[model samples]
Target: MSWNKLLCNLRELQLSGTLNGGQSFRWEYNKEMDEWTGVFSKTVWKLRQREEFLQYKVIGSLLQSIVQKKNDVEFDNNGVFEGLLKKYFRLDFNLSDYYTKWSEKDDLFKAACKQFYGIRMLAQEPVENLFSFICSQNNHISRISSMVEKLCKHYGEEICEQDGVTYYSFPDVEKLSTPKVESELRQLGFGYRAKFIQKSAAQILEWEGEKWFAGLQDMKYKEARLELMKLCGIGPKVADCICLMSLNHLEALPVDTHVYQIAAQNYLPHLRGKKNVTEKMYSEIGDHFRSLYGDYAGWAHTVLFCADLKKFQQTTDSEDIKPKKRRKKT
Candidate 1:
C-alpha cells in the first residue's frame, strides 16, 4: 500500500544480477512495468530499478505469528520494512570492498566482479531455503520457482488478494509434512520432487523444528554438511547450498555441473578428460575454490557461476536463465 524509494545505487545493487542469480525463487519480472514482484518472508514486494535509485512498493503483506498482524499500508511502519530490506539485501556487506579484494587476487574473479559486481548473496529464511533447495534437484530456476510458487499458492497461507494477485505465505512444516501433501505435489507437476519436499518437511518436523536446523548454523562446515545429509534427499551439493545461502557457512561450495565445466574449461583442464564429476573431483573442486577464494569461497563461486550462466545465455533478466544448460542431464 505504501510506495517507497530505496537509494542504493543501481550499480551497487543490480536486481538483474543479484535476485535473478537463482538464490531464492518466487519473484516475477514485469517487463512492461520494469518491476519485479515477489514474496519474501511474509511480505509481497515490488521493486524496480531506476538509474540512480530503486523504487519499491509494499503491494501486500502476510500475517505472521499468532498475533495475525498484517503489514498493509493502514498499519504500515516504514521502519519495520527498512530493517527487512537492509537485512534481505545484506547491505552491511560492502560490495565495493568485496570487488576490490576479489578482483585483486584472480583475473577470473576480477572479470566476474565487473559483470556481476552487485551480486550479493541473499540472506534467505533457513526453513524456506531448506525446502527450496530440495526442489532444485534436476531442476531449472524457472521450474524451481514455479514449484515453490505452487507450494505457496496451494499450501501456504493466503495473505491477501490485490488487483487479481493473491499473495500466500510459504507453507509451514505442519502443512507439508503429511503424505497427502506429497500426493498433491505430484498433481501439481512436482513429479518425484514432491516426495523429496514432503519427506524433507517431515524430517525437519521429526527433528522437532528449527532448533536442529538452527544448530547447524553454529556447526563447523563439515559437521554442518553431515548433519544436513541426514535429511532425506539431501546430498553434498544441496546441503552445501543450504549452508552457504542460509546457514552463513560462506565456505560451502555447492558444486554442480556448471562449476565442473567451468573449472575444466578454465581453471582445471585436467577435469576436461573426466566424463563425470566424481566424488573426489567434487571435493577437489570445492577445496580448490576455498584455496582460491578463501573465507567467502561459496559467495565467490556463486558470482562466477552467475557470470558463467550470463555468458552462455544472454540472461539480462533472472527469468531468462534456465537449467537446460545445467550439466545434470549431460
Candidate 2:
C-alpha cells in the first residue's frame, strides 16, 4: 500500500475537464491506498498513485501507457504526465486574459472557479471521454457514470491492487465489440446506449491499425472531431469533448446544455429563437473564443462551467441558511 512519494500538485489532473460532483467520468483519490483511481462503471483504474519519477518501477511505465492512449476510449498505460504538464499547463499561455474575459461577463463562471479552489482541469482518456460524453446525451450525470463504470468492470482486465482495493484495466476494442457481451450492459442500466457502445466498439475494432491511427491524424481539429462523429452515438458535442479532453486539442468547444446556456447568457444574447444550435454556430463561437483567449479555450470553458456550478450551489446554500419570518397572527 505504500507509494514512493506523492506529487504535491497532483490535483491538477482533475482540472483537465468539467466533472460535477458524483459524475460518471471523474477521478478521485483513495486516501488509504495513497493512489488516484478513476471509477467508471464501478470498475476502478489506478491512474496515478505515487510520483512516477520518484518510483521508477512498473508504475512509471503504466502511467505512460494510460496517457499515451489519449484519444482511445479504453484505459491503458498511454499517458506521460510530466511531459503533458510541461507542454500544456506550466508553459506560457494567456491564462489571465481568458480568466478576465470569462469573469467580466459571467458571475456564475467566476463563482464556480473560486468555489473549487482553482482545480486546474481534468485530462481524460480520449476513447473513454468520447464514449462518456456520447452516453451523456439526454442523460443525467449519475446514470452516465454508472453506465461507464459497469462497462469497465464487466469487460476490462484486472490490473493491480493497492491496499484492499483492486483496480481493473479498461477493455480494448476487441473485448467490447462483441454484441453478446455489450447486450449484457443493458442489464446494468445502460438501456438504449448499449447498442451505441457495441456498434462503435465493433466499428473501431474493424479498422486496420495504421488506418485507425492515420484517421486521427489531421491538421484541422474539426476534421478529427468529424471522423469520430461517424460512429454511432458520437455527435458534435461528444466529438468535441473527445478532442479537447483526450486529443489535447485545446480549442475544441463542447457545448452541452450547461455550456450552451453559459454561452447564450454571457456572450451571445442575440442567439435566441434558434430551435437547435447548428455546427456552424458552434464553430463561430469556438473560433471567437479561441481568437479571444488563444490556445486555452477548452480549459477556459471547463473552468467557467465548474465555476457556474459552484455559484449555483452557493446560492442554494444561502437560501437554505436564510431565516423565515414568523407568521403574523390571523
Candidate 1 shows a clash count of 0
Pairs of residues clashing in candidate 1: none
Q: Per-prediction TM-score, please? A: 0.91, 0.68
Error of 1 at 37 (Å): 0.7
Q: Write the per-residue lDDT of candidate 2 for residues 1-330, one digit (tens) a residue.
A: 233322433233333232332223445544454444454322333443232232212322244345447756654322333334334333234344455666675565566555453334344545566566656666654455556666666876665565675566556667778878656877777777788888888888777533673466544677888788888877777777677766767788776555666677777787655656676777767776677556767777667655555533422121321111000000
The models' CA-based lDDT, in order, is 0.80, 0.55
Candidate 1 lDDT at 271 equals 85
- How well is each residue in 243-309 modelled by candidate 1, as lDDT tens digits? 9988999899888787888788888888897877788999989999899889898988888888877
lDDT of 1 at 22: 74
User: How does residue 261 of candidate 1 score in lDDT?
Assistant: 84
Model 1 accuracy (lDDT, Cα): 0.80
- State in Å the error of residue 94, model 2: 9.4
